[model samples]
Target: KIKNWLSAPDSSRNMNEAYGKLQDGTCSWFFEGEQFSTWKEEPSFLWVKGKGKFLLVSLSSIIHNVDLAKQDSSLSMAYFFFDGRDSQTELQLHHKLIRSLIWQLSYREDHKVPLPLVNLYKKYGHQQPLDRVLRDRSFRWIALQIEELKKCASKNEIQKKLGKLPRGLDETYQRILKGIDRDYWDDTKIFLQFLAFSKRPLKVDELAEVITVDLGSEEGPAFIEDKQYQDPRIVLTRCSSLFLLLYLLNKTSGIIKLSHFSVKEYLLSPMLTKELFMSDAAFTNWVQLWNIDLNIWDQKRSRDKTDVMKMASALYYASLAGIKPTVELLLTNKAEVNAQGGWWGNALQAASAECHRDIVELLLVNKADVNAQGGDYGNALQAASFHGHRDIVELLLQNKAEVNAQGGYHGNALQAASARGYKYNVELLLINEAAVNAEGGYHGNALQAASAEGHRDIVELLLQNKAEVNAQGGEYGNALQAASFHGHRDIVELLLQNKAEVNAQGGEYQNALQAASAGGHRNIVELLLQNKAEVNAQGGYYGNALQAASTGGHRDIVELLLQNKAEVNAQGGYYGNALKAASHWGHRDIVELLLQNKADVNAQGGEYGNALQAASFHGHRDIVELLLVNKAEVNAQGGEYGNALQAASAEGHMDIMELLQEKDAINEDHKEEFSTE
Candidate 1:
């Protein structure tokens, strides 16, 4: 429970896994380097800088040496591998570094949790379960504060360069590319494209198998028996600098990966513009041929489901890329034209979305389901409509595509066309009876979609077509609130003129006034207020206009809300009240203003419980001092981390923690004196 509560990343486990794969004498040359000796002797930083194929393996050896030195000694050691492939959160990447280091230092020897950690756990453990409470607010707050530390660490670092090495990785990669044998150049290009454009890292055998099959042959994707390498490892030897073991999964069966992400970047980039990498047209042709051939090969190998998926994916991509020849070839090879896969679903939808007129015609000729609903924009018509592909929309409509079909991101063709401000597409869809008052998708109805995007012409067109102006749904509820929130003053006024409800509460920001205030649209706020908008309407992400304005650091908007009788002591939203929101976000002027307006300094609700705790947790020392001076309750406890001290402790905000401690001690002394009196 405690270990889980600590929330240290499992990078130590990753380190161990990599370390276990390290060969005994690998990177032995690094140990003999002068800078390595200096690093071992000194407390100062020594960066082992290189663009070598074996950098990861070398680092593993160094970590192993560090671990060996720490054995049976008082020395503490911690190491973490930063894998760029993993989508680590800001808290996990930055703050977890500090947490993991502290956890390691405190508990590495004999696995005992330090007294401070235990005290922290005990302090908040009673409020909720150890895991939930530890993570609730503390991690995010600490992560934000540690951003400065990350920036500082990035500054003025010394890097030890290897002697006689190429100054940059690009230069090294260039030389390696040039060094590939002339005989193997064509094969190597095919080998690299398979790696570069592959969905995931291909295994060594898989790569070899693909390379053995010749797609450009007159016989069509024939296997060259003599060209096959006996051992899978020999395939890697042909591409020297590009084939280092990129973190093996086990001893025998290793999953192959690019030497580095930069290798792929270099291959795809224009800097290496040579015969090594094919042009867009050539690459598309290659890919189309390869996909078709690979599918047949996979089918022969008895992997029918996987092969069909691959074929469908290829057809979708070929259509999407607007490659006529590729699409024709794919279809010729019996690629499923109506295959339900990829972002835009079928080949027809993909081609339509990208405005590939010829391909759309080709697909329709092949009897693709014109109204097929499955992808990002639902049907081919919706996809074409959303992307402003008028020609494709016309084509789909001519072929009996459904205009009022509701499914995708923008709901239907009408809504999609409206959101994108495609007037012609909107008109075309409307002409085809697209259900003008359609309600669904990201923006609910066409009017609100148009209004949200500030498409006034579309808004007018919709209204003129008797589109429901007050129809509620989508991100901003009604058109008026959407217009007001987006700061489209003209649209807001127009919607108001159309009798669109000003205080119509629904969607993300609840109503126009609060949305306008949150977005810092003072003119819109003023306009809404003039049109009888409710000043104290609550129910958005922020409780009310005043809280929203304060949270957004909109001083002018905050002042306007205050003048309009906005509540200062309102208890709702992420931070409970305007004061706490302002404090947490480091809006000192707004904090001061809220305090002046008699906002509760000891208000206990929201994420950090009180204004002082919110400020303390986020490292707002000035706000903490100001709140303390304004007589914020020092002992108040009930939100994320119990009290201000605990909040400060969670983030290691020493200055705020000390200030809180002094105030708590002073309050205790005063209590004692009062009791005696």
Candidate 2:
């Protein structure tokens, strides 16, 4: 059902089709709330009877607009403020906000006043310590306090600064911190958000290196290089602010499985995460799930500088250590696994194809859809097979991968293994009974593959197991054709013993014998002949085995045919005779052999006329003279010797023309003109 929906034409539908929770049109379980009895229909509200929390459930895209995200911020007291942060000015702004919040608390009546706010007022005096203020409130308040602290200029000038600070949470946090006088968020969220970004994980050396930024003293790094800098900490803290949060929530790679194009659109429209975090079971669940954004499967998102910077950071850690929380931090649960149109697909497919085992494993363990179609790459199995990572294949298979999954220039694991001659992988697929004749590339099945590569052991294994004896596919007809085409005599013999079709037709040539003869494989031809393979099978556009042998230059086989009571003057093919083909290819030895076999000399060849004409076309003047000596008619049209003088002059064969002219039997009127007309 998920596959059918994911591969559907409806782009406007919700793309979170890959998630198991979404199995019933919607997955409405949450953490921090009570558990439900069972799956329910589209209920408007969920009552967590134990937790005293009323969960509102809605089905929508997780991605929300940043402009619209402002709505979520409305509930926070310290919402992002548009102002500049200076010591004296921030003091003024803080004093004013303090007065307003204090007035609201003193009234004890402002519905806008939150319970946490009233509680904070009762706990902390009217002038709460700056350190205590930052620690007690939500991130929203911290952001507001940072801004209030950074009101560096007069009210008139604050807007100018806001105009210059850029329009995101990082800048918003930056503005707030510019004048912060209180404590920062707890050190744990700090370490988790920022240190995890570096993937350094607060090593002793790093923890030892601290830099400070004075709230009033925005000097160079040297001002407090040794001290744990407030500014740097703020930088780290603000890195996970709303803008950072959204960026983190939205940054998906090919491995991530996108649930929707817009994070807030897919996640919040339905209040999905709120529900997930509402229930302990949903949050604690360790199930593997894929995010499928079928709605925007083909949409391309232009990555901004932040995206690149984030990716660089992710890749850096990936190269040195391995993918940790970086993939999770950058991409959301709603990000697509097979995200096609970003900078790249989720990180796993890229890493796996490049043989980055660690990343592949990381992604797999993190619930990255192992079977998702990767960007430009077909799927994870294709990647593993192409790289011949036997272990990766094992991992994907363990994850329930489709064995014959098609992808790459040649589709599926079987074809890739066959092409690369990975005998063990071939055996794995064969033992597992992979699609026997799954056509991808020229070698479709394991039999043709083993035979083409002369894997005699593999061929014997496949044949004994009833693998297709003649699975005609791709360029070669089947196992017999591939072996005979490449002249694998041993493999050919084994196939025939297994009842392999001898007269099996193949690419550009009708049968295995024809292919062998065309390639001048004398041993293969002899073996096929011993099996009583057709000597005159005329199924190809190029005609029979005799013609294939003659054109490609095989003298021993030509004699063998004659000795075996083979017809020497079998006139078939575009090229009329065997001798014509031999002379056309300048096989003087073969031509002589054919002549000794009483072959027809005046037979026309493919685009080369008869034997003497074919010889003249190839500039074999010595052979031409030989043909003339054999009572070849000088005026035989289409033969190179037809007009002996004309043929000689065309090739500048002055000596041959002189010899021909010296013979009174040769007419001087036979001009040595090169003109075909």
lDDT of 2 by residue, 1-677 (tens): 22121121211111111110222213223310113211121324444332101111122211110112122223222111212111112222444445444442332112354566457656653453588664443554345445544856677676675556545433443443343333543332222222222322222222222222112243311223334432322443422333222112122211111111132222223343353233222211111111111222133434221111122223323322344444554344434334443222445556665466766675666667776764434676765665567777777777777887765444677765665556676677666667756766536666776676567876776666667787777556678887787667778888888888788776557788877776667777888888888787776644777777766556666776667666666776656777776665566777788778787676554555566656654566677777877766655665434554555566665665665555532444544343223
What is the Cα root-mean-square deviation between model 2 and the actual structure? 29.2
Instruction: Give candidate 2's whole-model lDDT.
Output: 0.50
Clashing pairs in 1: none
All candidates: CA RMSD in angstroms? 21.2, 29.2
Q: Write the per-residue lDDT of candidate 1 for residues 253-290, one digit (tens) a residue.
A: 45566655556766877876465566564466446544
Candidate with the greatest lDDT versus the true structure = 1
> What overall lDDT goes with each candidate model?
0.73, 0.50
For every model shown, what is its TM-score relative to the native structure?
0.63, 0.47
Instruction: Mark the 10 consecutive residues where model 1 has the least summed lDDT.
Output: 155-164
